[model samples]
Target: MPSRWLLSILTLILASAIVVACNGDNENTETSGKETDGGKPDDFVTLKMIMPGDESARMREFVDNELNDRLKNDLNMKLELTYIPWGSYQQKLELSLSTGEDYDLFWHGTPFVSGYKSKGYIQPLDELLQKYGQNLIKNIPAENFKLDQIDGKQWAIPSQAFTSAGKFTSVMVRQDLLESVGMTEIRTIADLEAFYRKMHAIDPSYYGYLETDRGHEVLWRELSGENLTAFDERNLFAVNEDTGELVNYVESDLYKKVAHLREDWVKKGIIDKNLVGNPQSKIDQENAGKLLFRVGAVSRAMENLQTAQKADSGAKLREYFLAPDKPRYIVAPSNEAYMIPAAAKHAERAMMFMNWILKSKDNYNFIIFGVEGKYYRIENGKIKLLTNDQLMYEWMWRNKNYFTAPTNVPDDVVRDMLHNDDNAKISRLFGFHFNEEPVKKEMAQVLTVYKEKFDLINSGLVGYNSGFSSAMTALKKAGYDKVFAELKKQFNEFNAGRP
Candidate 1:
C-alpha cells in the first residue's frame, strides 16, 4: 500500500519494453526475408539486354512500356535493351561475351549458340529450371528436351514455334519456268540437273540453278547421296542409325564425288562464277528474270516469293520438298536459340518474362512486331499487313521467334504452308541442351578450318577436287577423328538415359 505509485511506474515501463521487443522481432523477420529473397518489390533493379536494332516505333514502345511494366510489377525487375544492328550484331555479341560485359539474355544462332556454349558463357539451368520453371517443363516435352541437353545440362531454350523440320529443305522452282520448258516430272537431284542443263543449253542468258554462295557445297553433299559430318564443338555428329558410329562426311568417297559434280556444274556455266561473295547474287538474278530455279529452306523460300509477288505480279515461287526426291532426309535442329547468360543479374526475372511470352500471345506479339496498330494493321479477321517501311527491318534479328511458332499469322499463304509442312514440330526440341566442354578445344580448331575452307569451295574460289582434299587434310589435322570418337560415346550415354 505504501509503494502503490512506484509499482504503477514500474508496470508502465515493463509494458513499453514488451512492446519494443515485439516490434524488433517483426523488423528482424522482414529484414531476413529481404536479404534472402533478393529485394523488395518496389526496389529498382535494371537488367541489361543486347538485341537487334529498334527501327520500328511500335516495337520500341512495346519494349519500353508494355514489357517493362509487366516485368517490373511481376518480377520486381526492369529491362534495358541495347540495340545492335543485325549486320554488326555478331561482332558486338562476340565482343561483349569475350570482354565479360555485364549484360544478360542473348539471341543465339548457329555461330553464336555453338561459340558461346563452348566458351562456358552460359549457366546450366537444371536446378533453377526444376524449381521455378515448372510451367515451362510441362509445356516442352521430353523428346524436345533430349535434343537440347548437351552432356548433362540445358544451355538454351529452343524456339517453341516450328521445332520439327517441316518439309524443311526444298527446291524453290519457278513453276511457270518449268511449264515453259516442258519438264513436268523432275524428281531426283539428277532430274533437276537435267532440267538445269536444258535451261542453260537453250538460253545461255539464264542460270539453270541460282544458288547462294555460302551453303551450296553442303547442299551438294545431300543432293548426291553423300553423308556429311556436320557437328558443333560438342563433337556431336548427326546420329547415324546404320553403323552406330559417328559419320564423318569428309572421310567418305561420296564426298569427293559430290565435289566433282559441283565442279562439273560450274564448268558447264550452270552456276554463276561470281556468286561466292555476292550476298544478293541469286536474289538479284531471280528478280531480273535470269534464273530458272533456286534452292532454299521451304518455308522461307515460299514467304520470300510471296513478298516479292506482292510487289511484282509476275514473280512465282513454288516448293518441291526433298522427301519426294530423297528418302532419308531427316530434319535436325537448326543452330539458333534464346538464353539467359550466367552474368545476368536478372536471370530469374528474364526467365519469367520469357515464360509469360510463351503463355501470352499478346506479350509475344509485343516483343515480335510491336503494337499492332503502329507496325502492322489487321485487315480482316486473319491478316496482318506491315504499315510502314520503318517496321520492315526491325525484325531482322531478335524477333524471328514470333513468326516461327505459336503466334497466329494473318497471312493465309504462310499459315497454309505451315499446316502442310512436315517440319513444324515446335514441341519436339524444347528440352535438349548439349554440353561439349570436354572436347571444346579440339572441336574449335577443326571447326574453324572447316568453316573457312568450306566457305571458299562453295564460293568457287578453288577447284572442287583440290579443295575437297585440302579440306579433308585440314579436318584430319585438326583432330576430326578424336572428336567423332568422343561424340559416339556421349551420344550413347545420352540415349541410354532417354526413355
Candidate 2:
C-alpha cells in the first residue's frame, strides 16, 4: 500500500524518463568540449558537425594534430565530426532532428534541401551570415547563397561548386577501350551509341557507356533545357524559360525518343544485361577495363581512370561532357554546406572555429584531405595524390574552393580539365531559390513515387522498347501532374522575382 503522494511523485519521474527516451536529445546535453591551448573563451570554441561517411575520422586526426595541438590550443576550440554513414545517413539525420538532438553543423544540399527547410529542422542563417560570417559572406558570391534562401532568410551556406565548366555528370570513357574499337571521337549521345555498338561488335560485355542506375532523372534533364530540380515536378520537364509555361516531360516526345534509344541499345547487347539490377557503384567495374564508359563525375572518372592506368599500362581514361561540341547549360551548383542547428549551445564559438578553418590555409587542408605527406603530398611542386589507404578519406569532403587554399593539384591539370577553353562559357543562375513550402506535401509524395517507379523506367526495365510516351504516361499515373503544377507555380514566382 504505497501512499498517494509517493505514488504521484514516482509517476512523475517515470513520465520524465519516458519523455527523454522518446526525445533522444541526450547527445547534445552530454557532449560538451572546451577550447584547448590555454586560449581565451572568445578566441576559440568546439563545433560538432554531422558529415556523411567515416571520412570525418581523418579530418578529426588532422584537426587534433595540425590545428588543435598548437594554434587551436590557445583559441580553446576544435572541430568535431559525428560521422554518418551514407547508407542510412538520411534516416539518422531525420531521427536526430525529430528528437531535437543538438547539432551545430551538418552537410546538406539539393535532394534534402527543400525537405529539411520545410520541416523547420534547419535554422535560417541570414543573421548569422551578416554578423560573424562576413568574410564568408563576402567571399561566396551573392547568387550562390541566394539560391538557398527562402523569403530572404538564408537557411544554409552554399557549398563550393563551379557553375560554368565544372558542372558534374559526364560520360567518363576508357580511352583505351575506345581506341581498341577504332573510335577516336565521341562528342554527342549519338556518337556514344555508335561507340557502344562498336564495343559490342568486339564483345557483348563491352558497353559504350554504362548508364547510372539512378540516372533516369538526368536523362530528362538532358532532353529538357532546364536545370532546376524539384521532386513535386516532372523531373525531366519544366516551364519553358522562353514561354514561362509548364512542360510535361512524362508526356514529351523527347522522353519517348530516349527511351527507344536505350531499348534499341539494350537489344544490341551493348548494354550490360544485369545493369538494371546492379548498384551505381558497380559501374566502377567498367573503369577496370570491363566497359567503355560510365555515367559518373568527371573528378571520379579521373580517379578511377588513374587507378586503372596504374593496374594496366595500356588502359587510358578520358572524359567527354554530355555534349562537348554543342553548348549545353549544365546544372553547376554547390553540393554541401555547414549549417548551425537551432539547438547549438555555442553558436558564436562554432562560427569562430568555422571562420578560422576557412581563413587558415594549413587548417583548411587538414580539415579537407588530412595531414600532408600522409593522405596527400607535394612533390616537385605538383600535387601527388595518394590512394585511399585508410588516411585519404572522402573525396568530396573538401574541394579547391572550400578550403583556405587549394590543394596541391597541378595548375596546368586543373586549367586543362576544369577550365578548358570549351568550358569557359559556362555560367550559373544564382539567387534562383525555389520555395517549396507551398507544396511541401506534394513534393514529398513526388519523391516517393520517383524512388519507387522512375528507376524502372530509366533502366529500360518497365519501358523497354516502348517510346517515351508510354514512360510519360506511367509517370502521370504516379502523380507527376500534381507535382508539376506545384513546381510551375513556384518557378514562375521565382522568375518574376529575379533581379
Q: How displaced is residue 81 in candidate 1, in Å? A: 3.2
- lDDT at 336 for candidate 2? 55
Predict model 1's lDDT versus the native.
0.52
Q: Which stretch of 10 consecutive residues in model 2 shows the poorest summed lDDT? A: 21-30
**Which runs in model 1 stand beyond 4 Å of their true positions?**
1-41, 52-79, 83-88, 110-115, 127-139, 166-168, 173-186, 190-239, 268-270, 278-295, 302-316, 323-335, 377-381, 388-436, 492-499
lDDT of 1 at 252: 55
lDDT string, candidate 1, 334-357, tens digits: 334666675666665555545555
Model 2 residue 161 lDDT score: 39
What lDDT score goes with residue 72 in model 2? 57
Q: Model 2: per-residue lDDT, tens digit, 403-476?
A: 22123332433454555324332222323445566656765665666656665665555564543445456556
